[model samples]
Target: MSDAASTGFSADWLRQREPFDLAARSASLALGFRAALGPQNPAAFRIVDLASGSGANFRALAPLLEKDQEWRLVDHDPLLLAAQRSEITRWASGQRWHCHDHEGGLAIHAGPARWLVRSQQLDLARDLEDIDLASCDGLVTTAFLDLVSAAWLDRLSALLVRTPRPLLASLTVDGRRTWFPTRPADQLIADAFLSHQGGEKGFGPSLGVRATPYLAAHLAVAGYQVSTQSSDWHIGREHSDMLLNMAQEAATVATETDPSCKPAVSSWLADRAADIHHGLLSLEIGHLDLLAVPHFPVVK
Candidate 1:
């Protein structure tokens, strides 16, 4: 796999998508994960975020969690891990939270809440077992599941069952793509995009759209009570930049998948670009948020 694929996503792409990711996440599911953590020392609620790109998952989820949060943001890319502190600091400052270095990590104070975040650069494909899941109150990942293979998920399932904890996996692609002012080429583009998604992404052949369903089923069989909710992105005309990126990416992938489709993809791209320019384009990309908790007494 290429460095970009193996190391993880670029900070810029992650930044561009952060708002959409945050907006589309299921707040109810997040709150449920928080409840599953049960009561703990307000000063020591730990969470392990796998493939944490630029710490957006931490930012999106921290406030929704307990007042005191300790997050281990794990990723393979040193650059992304390195960028975490500044990104987090800027975000904290914007929120009017006091952010400072503490114990080789960042300590953020949001009113009465305290959050400590530490970045760990470990290739999840090799060092997933190295993570001390038992020590953390919960496990959370965003926009990561689809890139993993079934074998990897099986390993994760076994690990989770061995040391049970609530898991909130959000924004997993579910293979649905809807474009406004429908065109026949949309189906063609969607099919090619899904095909491209199944290619190796540093995890053998990726599960792609099948990721959430497969993980949910495995976790359920392991006696986890899993619930899923739609977290689709509803991109409107105002999000022309995002729309353009989506169109270009789709065209590129579609052409790569089948050279014969290049002409069609080029024409489709032209039409999409025109639509975006005219403020007539909108899109909906399907995603799912899954919360899996061990079957335990309900927490009110």
Candidate 2:
């Protein structure tokens, strides 16, 4: 995946934007998870976080579970994973105030935590084959699905269903273009850009806002019950500027896909950027978070 697509997990742009906070949205998901598990009694539940990325979700999820529970994080970026480990170590070493779940004795396992995060070093998508799927109680990923194509989602969904555990995914799809301070012209540009992004991913464009719905339908058809909710970034100046740049890039991509869009979309983006620069334009990026769990099959 390109740096832009992976930004939510890897790019300094999003790190600067504080994707770790994005994991807070998982609170509801964790509740849904406990509900699905129906009483966290005996054995500690095991969770696999795909594209774990600096342990953003882990940070959010760490405090909410039983200490004995094991969190098996998977990410292609070793650097981020290392950073995650560092954070974990820092927290683990802290006194009562540092540990989020001291009562639970939470253990932070680090594959490699320290230094620059690398991608190819730990590709979860392909490396996951070695995992014992049946042993996992739950699977999770945040701000990840939006970067994948429908085909990729289908493949992932199939793998998810094949596992003997429920899947709790949080894919933050960009919905800001459709809401307040929304520039109709910029919206069109964004659409064009998403379409181009799809092509690059081997999926035809037009899957932007529809990704969650599409995924839900796919999972439901596979015999899983799904729940969805909207999570807004509530853009501050920094976030708004970051999103503005993203919008511009998406618009540029759209213009590239269809040459005719160049004259119109380009001018619109330039003006939009100028307006943003002048503190006259603003937009909030909306994202959808989805939770999917298996409908426990009848014992009969």
Candidate 3:
């Protein structure tokens, strides 16, 4: 598989959706923008969301903004872009416009307006030649960044520094997943599973504790003001079925990389699954939400 496919994570894995619940908490952090912007600001605002999957951020942001705000949604996946388009259409009716650039995975749509879907992947670490940065006012993203390397973020920060827009990026990293609501036995298995999952990526060895703080450092280096909020998803025994499946996926990765880990991980998962079947296991997912802003150089 190519780097894109290997590093690419499916939002579909979020199907069981503890991640979505964690993601929704970002809405409050986004809404806090009003205090920063002040109360008297007009309803009309223009914002862009990158890597928008199923438009989760969009749905959360919509109710908080004026019904007339122009929203441009961009994602690299065609299916996700289509899903976002449908969601906007369904909720806002024909009031807002949508631009679906399927070729480049770029969609520029606003109110009652025609949209163009450009199928291209914009590397955050690279220069954005086709995108006109001057036209945008606000920037938004959610649950992205962990997939990117340091060099990529450097390029992104350089671009943001050059652009005049203030950015609102919400990055959710699994900070406490290993220590979340779980038994010591299960937690040990999960740690091994996550450790192995990290190895699947080329830079796996250092990524265990690297994602969150690294992003903050990169953004700060690029001159972005940053703040973070933590969100937790606590699931009771009732939802262990979904947790079991997630655990299974993680365990599978561990068992594949380290044969020695196979026996313990497999046994732990088996017991966990049995507990779920009998309504005995409860699970919790932990996430960290970061808010970052690009230091917009003042127009002289």
Candidate 4:
């Protein structure tokens, strides 16, 4: 339930899926990110996150990084931007970290390490060129790439070509959907849902499932050593609420994609709902996580 759907996702939905995202994210690419950014050891690195809804990227990546860091979270939604400070502060408090608000942003002190987190409001689709990629040590985005068209991704790759940086784009859907108790309509609904994914998420008809591989090729042509891994979501019986929400959303999107599929989609949802209540339904959603770095010039 990230921006991959092309929707300006609700903050509540963001909160709901965060734990699943944390659990499903790729492990190796995180190590790859660490390796990519570790050598610049003089001080904390400045990282920019594109479409950073409520600083979820920060909440996830900050602790994994050893150095004190400065982060910029960019998104078009003013509401989510405003929510970042309160949410992060609350989250840190739960972890016993001391958080303080300053003139510009919030600072979290976790024993010896401190991180400065700030949010910027911008329409990345319209202002991609306005971002100063050269100023940051790296770029990050999660559940965002699938919302963009191939041309938009090419623009990004071209910028990174000029100013090489470590880029971690994670949790993009790869078009695979599986449901337990395997109803006959499962594939039809999934097909329609995938079709709906391509219908304009403010980036002019997204590539949806093709996003990761498309970006990987583009960045590779720009001299980036691109790597990818599976970051599939495994929703089991424990997440009945999330599973049901996903079912409803899928049905809605499927109907929008193909009006003729409504009857089938409704039946599927009803069956899935019953299965959910009976603790019999589950899902495996396929997503990809990508890590890219300049292979040519050695950050000189």
Candidate 5:
């Protein structure tokens, strides 16, 4: 998934991280979200995915739903929105499902289950209010919360409270990172990355790793029962490309955050590269998945 901010994410990067995202997500939270939707018409079950990226969240959750569904994928980047149909179509085809263009979107058929997907381009920072959560059975987002500000989360919580729908937010970073065979500059690099994470990403100052806790508190205060679970990424030696990307990005951020650390960051990156070459490197990045549902009054 991608952030709603104007800082567009590369589709290639999103694709590369998708498998890890899928593996890290909490199936239990998905089940809880499905249950919260209750006994709705199977053919009319609807979900709205925020910052939908190339539709990874839809692909991840659709099978779990096991019902005929409609998904509205909302994102700020037209590039990502444009990529959604092809990605979903390819995925459906791989699953031996029938997929075709229908009404400017895509319709997918998997045995008795059918999914209708459509894309909408909206600047989430400005057009968040335009999403009609009341019309959807559920609201979902992935890898997006960390890019938003506390006030943005507050607005989201207020919206959810008013709409009273179940929400599943997956793969939000939780600030923890572990690298195998730790090096001397590891903490320095991590601290730099964390600082970079707090920089503006088109959503004012980002909440970064603090996003989930802040949002959870707001939702709880609004009478929504919230649950969270770890969704950390465990990158192994086999995932050399991913590890290399992580190391490179960290080096870039570290240098940018403190130019004086350039030599140290470069040395660290070189060592990590050697580790990847020798199949001696591994990494774990902490993330959290959250599910929140409004409390419903029981009838006597």
Candidate 6:
């Protein structure tokens, strides 16, 4: 489960899901970004990543954006922020990028592209406006919207109003999780998990599945043209660890929702575990990727 309330974020989960997030994000949106940036502005591309978890969004989008880039990764978790530098270095080494530790950030050169990544630990709820969006060329986030409230979205919209920028928000859970070969307690557990998604993640009454629409509407009102694409995670039986973690998270939430459901949930977990062990279980998780481009005032 990507949602932090249950399984939460571990190094294991982040590592497991990174490649899936990269593969599932809308490639066309990268084209949109290139077009938005245009060939004229060939100097520097500055982007701020919100709720950055170990810099997965950075690792995904950097190579795609063939430009000299600067990224400011923001998150509330100091521990995650601390991991950013090491995680990025490890990723760079794997890609065989010429990496160097710069004063303000990590400097890396891959083929013709150069990227500098920096980490910031900030309380986004308190400092959303405090972020210097006008200086940024774009904004990006992944697997984050479902954990925030409508009010938080409103604050974001208001900020975007001041300085219109291209935003690529990806991998948000849209409330669909399918366990293959079907189980009897699937719906009950799924319902409780969804309920937990809406509870709170430091933000009030998280929109969960309902977040995408609210965020889209707010962006539209702020003079942004919004587009969406499905960025679902299809977990096959081969990836046993993630599947097991997700199953465990589901049972945890279900039992918490209704204590009496423990027996039923336990049986469900056992069945799911066996299916996973035998490589029989598969999962389809619904997620949405939203691209918002501000309609800049046409100069007469």
TM-scores for every predicted model? 0.95, 0.73, 0.73, 0.96, 0.96, 0.95
TM-score of 4: 0.96
Q: Looking at model 3, which ten-residue stretch has the lowest summed lDDT? A: 1-10
lDDT of 6 at 47: 87
Q: After superposition, how far is residue 37 of candidate 4 from its true place, in Å?
A: 1.3
lDDT of 5 at 193: 75
Q: Candidate 5 regions off by >4 Å?
A: 1-6, 297-300
Indicate the worst ten consecutive residues by lDDT in candidate 4. Answer: 1-10
Report the lDDT tens digits of candidate 4 across residue range 1-300.
Answer: 534333878788889888889998887897788788864687887889999998888989888886788899999999899889888998999999999976598989977888999889899889998888877888999988988998899889888987888999989999998998799998888888778878788888799999999999888877789999999999998899999888888888888788897888888889999999999999999999999988875463
The CA lDDT of each predicted structure is: 0.88, 0.59, 0.55, 0.86, 0.89, 0.84
- For model 1, the stretches where C-alpha displacement exceeds 4 angstroms are 1-8, 40-43, 296-300
Q: List model 6 lDDT by residue over 41-68, tens digit each.
A: 7677888999998999988888888789
lDDT of 5 by residue, 49-112 (tens): 9999999999999999988889999999889999998888889989999998888879999899
Candidate 3: residue 284 lDDT (0-100): 56
Tens-place lDDT digits, model 1, residues 144-251? 998889999999999888888899999999999899999999999988888878888887788999999999999999999999999998998999998898888888
Residue pairs of candidate 5 with colliding backbone atoms? none
Clashes of 6: 0
Q: Which candidate model has the greater lDDT, 3 or 5? A: 5
User: Under the 3 Å rule for N, CA and C atoms, how many clashes does model 3 have?
Assistant: 19
lDDT of 2 by residue, 22-74 (tens): 53364787788766754435656666777777666665664555344566667
Model 3 per-residue lDDT tens digits across residues 244-291: 666676566556656686778778777777777888766655556666
Candidate 4's C-alpha runs over 4 A off are: 1-6, 298-300
Give per-candidate clash totals: 0, 6, 19, 0, 0, 0
In model 2, pairs of residues that clash are 67-104, 76-122, 79-117, 82-112, 82-113, 195-205
Model 6 residue 13 lDDT?
A: 70
Ranking by lDDT: 5, 1, 4, 6, 2, 3
Which runs of model 3 end up more than 4 angstroms from their true locations?
1-15, 22-28, 34-43, 88-131, 178-188, 193-209, 294-300
